[model samples]
Target chain A: GQQVMQIPQYQHVQEGEDFTTYCNSSTTLSNIQWYKQRPGGHPVFLIQLVKSGEVKKQKRLTFQFGEAKKNSSLHITATQTTDVGTYFCAGKKHSGYALNFGKGTSLLVTP
Target chain B: EADIYQTPRYLVIGTGKKITLECSQTMGHDKMYWYQQDPGMELHLIHYSYGVNSTEKGDLSSESTVSRIRTEHFPLTLESARPSHTSQYLCASTRGGSGNTIYFGEGSWLTVV
Candidate 1:
């Protein structure tokens, strides 16, 4: 079985501050996906990282995958009030089809 | 936006009652999944289907059962509901490809008394 762990279960920051959440897996992953869930809403896909040591950016958000494919991180620069939500990382093993999800990091921004 | 639909956005039922959460996706995806989530908690996989007549239990142990008779429909049924069963259920589907994005439904909020 594959397991994914995320750090900083909860974070509260002032608007325009930065935030980061790290994810680690027990085994190497074939691919990893990030998701965001707003208050009272379902999870929405944010980005997916497939190649090892890959870095992808979307607006103010930046995603990075470890060279070993066993860790990932999401960093948000100058967070806004609209960034309040829980970010989850899901990892898929090389030999499995199911995606094992981490507990997630909840972000709260104060305006 | 995804074309996935979940019925009964909210449900409040008494204990021992039977209920079914209906999930349907028009994207013709072969992979469908059901996840349970609590307030401020992580998403827990409950059940998933690869295709018609294929069903598998997820990492989390759940009392619910699911059926995949059609490619578009994957419904979860609770024969005897309890308070512990109260949680938000989300239905999602993926097109089955490398780096495929999963689309989730709005979710069904269930509360058992």
Candidate 2:
């Protein structure tokens, strides 16, 4: 079975502070995706990384995929109150079937 | 919006009752998925369908069964509901390749008494 683990199950930080969440997979992945879910809302796709050692950014958010496709990370610079939500990392196995998601890291930003 | 819709935003049913949660998407996406989640928690994939007549169970085992008779509709049914079945169920659909994003419905909150 394939498993994806996320570090820091929960996090709290002051506004404007930087935060990062790491995701690791027990098996190699064909592609990895990131998602965010606000309080009481369904998960929303943020970005997807397929190439090895790939890095992508959206405003204050930066995403990275490990060269071996076994791990990934999401970094938020200068966090804001709107950033309060659960960040999840998802990966597709070699079977190319469905996407498996991590437990997620809940981020709480305090002003 | 992505046009993914789920009926009965909230439901309360007694144990031993049979219930069905309806999911429909106008996006014409061939891929549909059903996931269960608790408040402020992780999403557990319960079922998914690549297209009509194609359904598969996910990592988490579920007591629910799903049907994909039409490309735009995928519904889940619980034969015997229990208190443990109380959770939020989300429906999603996606087009294009695996790289495409999944668009989710608001979700159906079910509570069995």
TM-score: which candidate is best?
A: 1
Error of 1 at A24 (Å): 0.4
Candidate 2 residue A17 Cα shift, in angstroms, is 0.8
Docking class of 1: high
Which regions of candidate 2 are displaced past 4 Å? none
Worst 10 residues of 2 chain B by lDDT: B93-102
lDDT of 2: 0.94
TM-score of 1: 0.99
Distance from true location, Cα of B41 in model 2, Å: 2.0
Residues A52-95 of candidate 2: C-alpha lDDT, one tens digit per residue: 99999999999999999999999999999999999999998767
Q: Which portions of model 1 miss their true places by more than 4 Å?
A: none
lDDT of 1 by residue, A1-107 (tens): 78899999999999999999999999999999999999999999999999999999999999999999999999999999999999999999888877888999999
Across B6-77, the per-residue lDDT of candidate 2 in tens digits comes to: 987999999999999999999999999999998877889999999999999987899999999999999999
